[model samples]
Target: MAEKFTDEEFAFLRYARFGSLPERVKLEELVALNETEPAPDYSDLAYDAKERAEG
Candidate 1:
């Protein structure tokens, strides 16, 4: 089975895969912004209904 990832984890994965120095820096900026900002509600985001039903 595949593992689920958080937004931060996905960002890190992107950094590990195809990111350049600038991209890494931008990711850091995004992290900092996230830390300072209010968290977003993800209830409206798309999800796999089959996976949810299976779980």
Candidate 2:
């Protein structure tokens, strides 16, 4: 846990967090999937109300 980990220390850190030799991309995907984005564009929701208003 020095200011900068040595090569061995860095390798150990990565393995500890991700298990042995895990794919970096898979880790990124997992983290991304767990993240919450905005409510997404729902301004176009359709319902019978719009039809009733039109007719």
Candidate 3:
């Protein structure tokens, strides 16, 4: 089994990984980014191994 990290260790890990962003992103910008992309079409995609093997 793996050992659990303490609160101090977890804080240190988060700081080391992400540090701090120079500027905060606006909520509007985030919403616009998501809206800009169209959802993908998976209508013709195979859902099983048998279908994949046949094709």
Local distance difference test, each candidate: 0.67, 0.70, 0.73
Question: Could you tell me every candidate's TM-score relative to the true structure?
Answer: 0.33, 0.36, 0.35
Give per-residue CA lDDT, model 3, range 19-55, as digits (tens). 9556887777775333466644565343455587988
lDDT ranking, best first: 3, 2, 1
Q: How many backbone clashes does candidate 1 have?
A: 0
Estimate the Cα RMSD of every predicted model relative to the unseen true structure.
18.0, 9.1, 8.7
Of models 1 and 3, which has the larger lDDT? 3
lDDT of 1 at 34: 36
Model 2, residue pairs in steric clash: none
lDDT for position 21 in model 2: 72
How accurate locally is residue 27 in candidate 1, as Cα lDDT from 0 to 100? 48
Q: For residues 1-55, what per-residue lDDT tens digits would candidate 2 score against the true structure?
A: 6497799998899988988874467554664346577664555445555777899
- Residue-level lDDT of model 1, residues 1-55, one tens digit each, is 9999999999899989987455235544554333466555565333555567779
- Which wins on TM-score, candidate 1 or candidate 3? 3
The best candidate in terms of lDDT: 3
